[model samples]
Target: MKFATTVLLTSAIWTTSALAAPRAGFGVPPKAPGDKNGALAAEQSTSADIEYGYNWAGVIHTTPPATGTYTAASATFTVPEPTATDDSSGGKQGASAWVGIDGGTYRNAILQAGVDFYVEGGTKNYDAWYEWYPAYSNDFNLSISAGDIVIVKVVSSSPSQGVAILENESSGQSATQTLSADPSTATLGGQNVEWMVEDYQSGSSDVALVNFNKVKFTGVQAETSDGQKIGTDGATIYDIQQNGDVLTNVTIISDTEFDVSYEAAQ
Candidate 1:
């Protein structure tokens, strides 16, 4: 997937994030932060629920032992070494870390993979991606740095078909992306199950945002459909608040483990 013919509609109503419109990372979930144009109503209320979006921030589960749906998902992050954030006037700044399956509440499609960090002026880069969210973002010659140790996963066999995997494990290197047909016809409705730390998009808006200062996710599992294998206590917490500050601060550390840090915004 890589055809930026210009498409912009990253909607993350945070039913745990993304709210469909995919990108779960890339142009990165939009439409929640403050209701850019106004149109979001997911929230079911389990307790957590601290909204704000523009490019996701962390954690977001599905159901509540309320049956099954998700195909599969996994996480194990640690590759933050991005600097330059005063909004990074130096041109570009992005940070991505993913583990997705369905763009949360079936916003069309999304089966992800992760690892991406960039700093323009000072020059810094890294890659290892995979996607199927409204398209765009496909690179995995595999070669990463800066704390490495990643382990992203995604799986789906129906709703269009999918399979994305990325593992850096500090360097052991691993990358796989299989698809039978899941491009523009994207459609994965396993609902939401995400663990992101993203601030992506370089063409239609949202770039400048480095200071990765934080990013953590430990084997946060997910594999439902009936087989059952979920974790994420009572998910629902997304940080990242653009102009209003409130960079991020999500901490769960239970049903699997979670922690997303990086303040500075105010």
Candidate 2:
């Protein structure tokens, strides 16, 4: 979740990919091709009806009181299978859908987990993973596919420690792992939880964006440090933007549900 601090200020928008360096940790997975030091591109999207960004085409929680300390966050989403696009840059386009805590106003770190839906070489790939910011995400051994119901949760046992769990409800398989917060980095504030789908980026180059028709998140909830459960009703909608355009519109369906409609901005 670490990127250049300039992104936090909407006025100082920059077009280059905002990828951060990977921090050292256990279970560090190998980098994927085009992945720069474990840094994923900032999400960007486009559409006249929605807002935009570099590769992210989803909603974020950005309104006031939306930022607060939290202990845990969870959500269930249907994995999307986006059609691959032939990028003029000689790469395939794709997106990753995930729910996580932090990375909004509290930008220091993020504790999150979710699934990646991508198309490469005309083939679609779906995989589940969990991440503690500044470190490369670790992939789960469980199998995943488009349309599968997946549940992901990240819970903080303490400010610097937590656990991430991912389950494929349809297949009855799951993965759980312990996550230690980086002491050298900012402590996760547990504020600003989010559910989003982002276009994968490699360094400063934009990866092709996959057409993941539509994706929805249900049972979206979080627990505060004081143990109160917060739902989508308590959150403010944030549209992912690139330059000055809106790419997606986030609709609050209910206190526990929300939907992100892709505007398919090129």
Candidate 3:
């Protein structure tokens, strides 16, 4: 029951569309990032290759329990006001903070919902979105400002059916979307659950990641089909490593809380 001051909200009707070309989306790891010459690329496949990503950071539940499939995951985070940095993507830098089931070891489709932030020409902007991986993300017309508390959740009714929810605690408004894993041939494996900070794709290239000082995901949790709730107790941590540079740091403060800090992009 805690919040920052000066919270604000804007609203628009929720809409959905299927996009195939030149769309923006959170993608599977293209490869582990390394320096300008692909140093990490030529190195042996260490744990970093499994834990590091060119576009993702945060923690993932790599080892699930032996008995049941995971059904849901959620996280609470404060909206970050991204600032334009020197190595900017031509005023087109941003990041996505999301929670989802699969797409970690599942490697096919991700069921997720959360927020996208961008700093263009010194202006900060945000949008709430939900997606079933390989399909482009559609936006929620929820106007949000820096420091607002947002809670996002993804639930799977079955391997192929699910729902995503995005709630703005400060505004008392929310968006919910029931989803299906149809466009994507991959269904949820229910093996990996994760919370991520991602640098997404725009067309064939990545948008430069701006400096999002610190984004902490609290109330971090997941649940099993048998009704058991889980936390970050046994999770494998991941950070963004691009071209021989580590771009972010993830600190697990507790089972229910963690923080990701931005490092400069080259």
Candidate 4:
């Protein structure tokens, strides 16, 4: 029933075709036509090393506005490990989930924490298959060349933090790399880029923007130990937008506690 309640739904009208190249493309390509019922019927392995993608066309201000490709937008859902269940009933108690952006290298692509996206089931045992939207929103307009790959990673806050990757549209030239710790330095497309982090504990969920095009790439850095850091090494940050103006360290209390705001960098 949850999947049925998706805020965003994708509809496909293509003639049935065999599972084409598993390369990343628009929304997890439909399972192979024959995969409807078979041994791989419930193949829920999130580590299939498959491709991910999306299509774009929405209300905006730009005239003849730019149209995003299958790679323009993406998100990663990391389902933290679940606690041991009451074997007697074989049902888990609870789980924690985190999300990250994926598209290009940490440098080439802009990634921000506290963003909202779908959490697809991947390599995790679930009582039911469903998707949840993040209370926050972060957007980025990447300037990738013809062939580029964007990777989205998600982290869980409970049990044990988990990570999954989303491979977005690529020109067969883009690449992605993950780092366990903040990197000493980073350069976007070989050009040094600056990174900054801002923290606010006012329960405000407004997105903080870090313009990628105007990076300086040389500074000490800042963060809030007791709070969330919007930008980390390899991760690009941005300003939060409200009514077309920029706000700082605020949450979108319009509905959820974690609902933040954001937009693609110009």
Which numbered prediction scores highest in TM-score against the true structure?
Answer: 3
TM-score of 1: 0.33
**lDDT per residue as tens, model 2, 107-191:** 5667777787766666777767777776666777889988899999989887788999999999999899998876556467775
RMSD, one per candidate, in order? 16.5, 7.3, 8.9, 20.5
Which parts of model 1 are misplaced by more than 4 Å?
A: 1-48, 51-59, 62-65, 73-83, 86-94, 100-112, 129-139, 142-153, 156-192, 198-223, 227-235, 240-245, 248-266
Better of 2 and 4 by lDDT: 2
Q: Rank the candidates by TM-score, best first.
A: 3, 2, 1, 4
Q: For candidate 4, which ten residues in a row score worst on lDDT?
A: 55-64
Worst 10 residues of 1 by lDDT: 1-10
Measured against the true structure, the TM-scores of the candidates, in listed sequence, are: 0.33, 0.76, 0.81, 0.18
Q: Considering TM-score, which of the candidate structures 2 and 4 is the better prediction for this target?
A: 2
lDDT of 1 at 102: 62
**How would you encode candidate 1's per-residue C-alpha lDDT over 142-183 as one tens digit per residue?**
888888888888888777787888888877989788863445
| Candidate 3 residue lDDT tens string, 1-266 | 00000100001101111121222223422333232224332222223222455556787786568878788999999999898888774557788788989765555666877787887677787878887765655666676778989999999998889999888998888888888875657578788788988775454455677789999999999999878888877676677776667788888788899899998855
Question: What lDDT does the true structure give each of the candidates?
Answer: 0.68, 0.62, 0.69, 0.21
Error of 4 at 237 (Å): 16
